[model samples]
Target: MDFIARATAIVGGTMVLLRRMSAPAAQAVGLTPTIPEAKKQGIMTLKMPTAKGWEPGHKPTAAQGLKVNAFASGLAHPRWIEVLPNGDVLVAEALQTERPPTSLMDRVMQATMKRAKAIGVSANRISLWRDPDGDGVAEVRKVFLEGQNQPFGMALVGDTFYVGNTDGIVAFPYEKGATKLTGPGRKLVDFKPGGHWTRSLIVSPDGTKIYAGVGSLSNIGDSGMEAEEGRAAIWELDLATEKARIFASGLRNAVGTAWEPVTGQLWTVVNERDGLGDETPPDYLTSVQDGGFYGWPYCYWGKTVDDRVEQDAELVARAITPDYALGGHTASLGLCWMPEGTLPGFGDGMVIGQHGSWNRSTLSGYKLIFVPFVDGRPSGAPRDILWGFLSEDEKVSYGRPVGVTIGPDGKSLLMADDVGDVIWRVTGA
Candidate 1:
């Protein structure tokens, strides 16, 4: 380790002494949860649990009657998952390459990213996994797509496939059962990059429109409003005209996008801003309305103003409150609706992948949670569906959950464990 790494490790150790909120209290900041007094730290707390590969014959513990099994293993940082109509599982073996640091905090963050095993040469490819025997294990795995940038979200509409790379959206010709793509893709739109880099893609129910979500460049317009142009919002693209427009705005980082089954309303799980104590502004899941602004720099949780940001009286008044809060700094990423009649007791709801947090002393998220819904609205508190990623000592992590989707059979829940490089399948035991 170099000087920056040593300094970061030492500071990380001292953050343990900082006052931290209990998990229950932090979660209470969820739907109508309390917002504690905010306190901006001199140096943002850094308490990420180091990654540790799973031991043999061990796996994550599933909820009550559900069972967890490895569908496929030995992947290269699988971060997103997509299942085809023919039951083939597609996993994006993607990771971010090393970015040059520009500031002291940037250097510290880079050192920590190395410890978390998140920085290196990205695989820049997607692989296809198949379990035709329905035996809960894959029998075939092959490279499906190659020569791509940092790809995350993927969608298939008819015979055309779309991928949301960190910088733009690309489309390729795809066949029903073919395992590989032989044609080069066309770019749809170029996204402005800043802080958050993940882009999630979702096609409209009618298959005519594509929704691409891009996150803000900075926590609160720190790079100036010019740097945030065409960012921190969801863009709707029309296939016929190849035209796009902003669908929603002021969402700091909308990484997960899904549509409610009954009402067809678009919903997203957003990662809120950091450095506001441990429970002031909670990350949330909200129904996206066209031309909506949810307040990123100026305020949060509806009308609660954040004095740290320059007051925007006009913008603050128009900020819409999110529908449901997930938790503070949970880093909620993947969002998918549960198919009805699957996973009894799981209820009609959406499963969220909380990739965990690094800005808190006690740590938050790092598991899969089920958020129940009724009549097109969030009904209750989130329930843990998969956990045990963090060790008992809270110093090591087996992996962190990211993308989530329903299997082609509509009975299994497919999850991506990026750090562990494994795809986990959850079914009713």
Candidate 2:
């Protein structure tokens, strides 16, 4: 980082929030889920206020021939988001994973307004939002998939919308142009949603196979050192055959996966393990090779082994890690590769949602970043393309971005903020 950039960050860091409010809901869903009964207090819904010395928001305006607008607002923890054929969106809220409900004592707290209502988790479902008027806003949003575990990733294949639940995969006969879902489909696969279980999925461009990423069940393989039944791997399911097998392995957790239109190279953003004391292994965005390994608990960031887990530093020195380290704990997820060709406006660009940071002392990365790529490869380091969701000093300003997509209208961009349960669009005005 240059001096000016570094200095800007120092200014920005001051505003980062040091206190904890409502935890980044998506991160909680992806990592730890404590039983509500075990906790003495209710889940926090407070938005941590920004720090007094935080940097100012450097949010960008849509380039010429481009416009950005807020499509909808008032959402609750919008997690994995997918665009539908008829200009609608399918989203899952990781509410079901909100620790098992508490007991009578917890109920007392609820009655006293100390906790949220309902002991049972309603998070196990997906919701649909539609912008029928096409006025650059979602006028309606309703539940589409229900009774789920931790419904996260979603993909549309013809009439079937594949929903990735914490425990498995299910297909629903999703209807377009409708604000509600009332039908059920079939289950494609049953999975073990554990340690690292935020499933991100995509269908092959040709539409024959489905690729779903399942994160590690252990912090690194060491937690489950012995059990390897589908831990830390991306599995490919033959859409025509319904058979699933490991597609790639050793990725601690690859949250976002997309195919570069110009080159068809696979790209991903992975969440490397934590507890390496804040600076060890860096999370990354890289082109994933089929049958290749981006070492997890064993290595990271161009083959740097984590000394905490791997005893032999020599082995860590040899492993191949990710191509681009997206800094530590930025929590990059839901990737979208830009336009078809090498246009000046976008140099084979990619957009990643940096879902903010926890586990670290000060807050960082709760916005969108642009990773410019060319000729099917990264041309340079990522720059904060879309920022300001988190306050200048560390408090959340507007909302946390979970997913990014081209609007159903095909001209603008849509970003989902999980906390607000809202969808905002950036389009040509």
Candidate 3:
């Protein structure tokens, strides 16, 4: 093996054998989950599984009484899915650009990423897929928007379609049932580019505003606080005034957002910081409160202080606890919640796409989970609705799911698998 790959494997394997020092992943989930004390790491665990695309006739295993099929395939790193009002699906084809190798750690991480098949040029385009006959497969495909800057999130408000690129949010004019966007979009807001690059966008229930989730530039302001301005928070943008302001702060990486139907509240799934063992702090799904702060660099889970960050007792004191713990390093990203009748047996819950883990000795995610809700709040144990993203040996991955959305028909769930470059459709049997 090459030096970097071998080195990472040796370290990761050693940690697996020494996992007694870490908390089990199952202990860090659900509404009243445990948060074990942090174990500071000089070098975080590097356990990225090799990406192996699925063979012909292979697909992710669905839950009992559910069927899985590829809605569309051969997509270039499909990362997010948005279903239009007319049953059209929009898939974002985005890839992360390799950062310049300026430091030894940077070079090492880049090499590890290459071995895991993660280093790729961004396609920077969105495509529209249509299954006109109610078939699972999309028979009609077209490039909806091209020449974007690693776009991820997409939203449609009235006649305007908005896309959240890595550097900004842009708006495009749209016609009903149109497949292509011919004109350039106007920039709504600019974002500072760094570590957490995906910007998740969601329109308000009343359609008066747009909320954009911007992640931190560094894990814990390591790139400096100035570099993190206008990041690690959700920004509310007024549609009428074209003005924006920070909606909530101290979110490390809120990658998905949805409006709760019963309460009309905004909820998001956030990926937390790393380097504190495998299960110190958990990723979470929480209701977004305006002007609220959840601790990031200073603390977590509402006052479990992080010593690595200089003491900020005041800010830590004000940190709000997240609504649900998604387990440490799960990389929970895509979130979609529907009313009780949408999917049978998975009633009134949020469907989350966990993108899996790279920093844990043993993987924690790599599956889709359903968090049942009681009166707009998460309750009960999360149900595993989809699995088989990783190979049986657990050393190779068939795919990693990102964005998920309920189909326009309201009976299907669409998932974007970046590693497999396919859009998966899940439906009741």
Candidate 4:
């Protein structure tokens, strides 16, 4: 190994030893997670499992009352999913765009991501999957759109279909039951792409607007707050006017978004800032308020300041506490509202597809989980819906779950497994 690689190895070894010496803190999960003191490190904990895909006939283990099957396979880094009115499923297949490492930390992160199958060339396309027979598996697959820049989110509003590319939102004309879109799309808005580039799109209940989740450009304004402008928050786009504005700010990386059926409020799952021990600031699920700030580099979990960033007393005072904590470094990326009876024994709740963690000694998430909600607020503890994506020893990952949605049938669940390159469907046993 080169000098830098050798140095990284030595540092990694020391971190592992230190982690073992200090026992892991109690898990921070649920509506009231015990936020621990911040323990900053020059080099954050880096323990990523090698990505070893599943063998033939292998699949994730579903919950006791549910059965799992590969709805579609052979995808190229499928990361997000959208279901059409005609019961066809649309999947966005893309990965992070490559940029040369500019620093030692960048090099280390790039190498680690490669080992975890998180780095790759973007497929830059969206494909359609149709299950006409209502059988668990999809028999028809077609490339619906292509030649796009790192697309992640798709929304069909009226006759216009919208795509959330890494750099902007693009819209194309569409027809009901149509299999492919051939027209060149028009750009609706621009976004600074690169760091934390996945833009998740969701349409409003009235179909008059769209919400896009844009993540931060750096871990904690390390590149200066100016570089993070128009990012790390959700943008509301007026469909009629084709203009967008920041809806909520101060979220480090809010990736998934959904609307609460009862309250008519917007909710999101946010990936918190890193380098603060293994369980200091937990990834969260919260009801997003219009014009509300949730504290990104300035503070966390309400007014608790992160001392690392230059103090912003005014902003910290206004930071809204999240509604629920989903565990630290869990990388929760996909969120969808699951109405009662959609899945067996799963009531009105949100299904989150945790992409899993790479910055902790022990892995946190690599499966699908459900957080029950009563009267539009999260209630009970989270329950595992599907697991076994990681090996028993936790050194190898067979898959990483990403975007999740209710399947076309309205009774099943569909999850995108990017590492496994398969769209899994979950149904009642």
Number of the top lDDT candidate: 4
Over 261-300, each residue of candidate 4 has an lDDT whose tens digit, in order, gives 8999999999998888788789999999999999998999
Q: Specify the poorest-scoring 10-residue window by lDDT in model 4.
A: 1-10
TM-score order of candidates, best first?
Answer: 4, 3, 1, 2
Instruction: Score residue 160 of candidate 1 by CA lDDT.
Output: 92
Error of 3 at 77 (Å): 0.8
Q: Could you give candidate 2's per-residue lDDT for residues 1-429 as a string of tens digits?
A: 134334433433442333233223222211111111111112211223222212333233444444555666545566777887766777777742334334642333233221111122446667777887778777787877777777788888877778787677888776656565567668899788755668878889999888888887766665455664686778898989899988877788788888887788778888876554333455777777777766766766655555556454554555555667665567787688766332225555788887766534445567677777777777665655456666555533455567777667666667766654566676544
C-alpha local distance difference test of each model: 0.85, 0.63, 0.88, 0.91
Candidates in order, TM-scores: namely: 0.97, 0.76, 0.97, 0.98
Clashing pairs in 3: none
> Residue pairs in steric clash, candidate 1?
194-217, 195-217
Give me the displacement of residue 259 in model 4, in angstroms: 0.7
Rank list by lDDT: 4, 3, 1, 2
Question: Among all windows of ten consecutive residues in candidate 2, which has the lowest summed lDDT?
Answer: 30-39
Candidate 3 residue-wise lDDT, 158-178, digit = tens: 999999999988999999989
Model 2 spans with C-alpha error above 4 angstroms: 1-68, 100-122, 175-179, 310-318, 340-344, 395-398
Across residues 195-287, which tens digit of lDDT does each residue of candidate 1 receive?
577778999999999998899988878878888888889999998888899999989899889999889999999999887766657888999
- Error at 283, model 3, angstroms: 0.5
lDDT computed for candidate 3:
0.88
